[model samples]
Target: MDSYAIKYIGLLCLLLAFVSCKKKNQNSLPETMKKDFVTINYAKGFSIEKPASGITIIKVYSPWPDADEAFTYALVPKALQTQPQLNEKEFDAIINVPVERIIATSTTHIPALENLGVIDKLVGFPETRYISSEATR
Candidate 1:
């Protein structure tokens, strides 16, 4: 495909992603929901936390080489009616949980996305030749 076509597709994907995610959850999250979480012990790349029920907080540290700081994001379950109020500076983004789509840069992330049953959500990736998965290609 030409550059124009590639750009158009990427833009369309982004627009579609944005539109699909704009819906609000009609039910408010349960106040009594318990926190369920996994412990991140070895990987310095990221850490996960559950500060509240129906919310998952992720902090990625030095995701890239020479990165000085971590990026934080809040993930709320789709069933949640409203996002909990949080300090603005605490998170880079507050996204609905169970992401609908993704654009992967590194091939290392492909397997995980696939395993999560979201590989079909791959909107774009560079160097298609490097991708061995027939499903992805």
Candidate 2:
């Protein structure tokens, strides 16, 4: 192979390694709690951590290249879910899991919801014209 082809292959290998090695939260969890955390499949820019205390933490990384902020969500147990607590301020958004209904704002989100087989969870869209998917209608 030419020098340019060899260089391109080397560059591609480095790029793949960088993306694959992206850091994940390293917070320690109890052995018992680790088994209860739901495994998120085929997802990017998010991580879930559940402590034995019963509250679940979800960290969502901003997809935008220019955005430096990431959002945190705390899912409190049913009994204490309604009561506001001091730590609630740390989360960007928090609510009970199995969110009943949501207004899907973009078409790009449709595929992810569809892939999760939860397209029925969407109750509305900002603009109907952009939704070309018949399944979403």
The C-alpha RMSD of each candidate to the native structure, in angstroms, is 26.6, 19.2
Q: Which lDDT tens digits does candidate 1 get at residues 1-137?
A: 99999999999999999999997876755655545567877776887877556578888888799998889988878887365566668889888767777889998988888798888888889888888888877
* Tens digits of per-residue lDDT for model 2, 5-60: 99999999999999999999879775545635568898778888877666788888
Instruction: Return the clash pairs for model 1, or none.
Output: none
Residue 4, model 2: Cα distance from true site in angstroms: 88
lDDT of each: 0.80, 0.80
TM-score, candidate 2, is 0.57
TM-score of each: 0.56, 0.57
- What's model 2's overall lDDT? 0.80
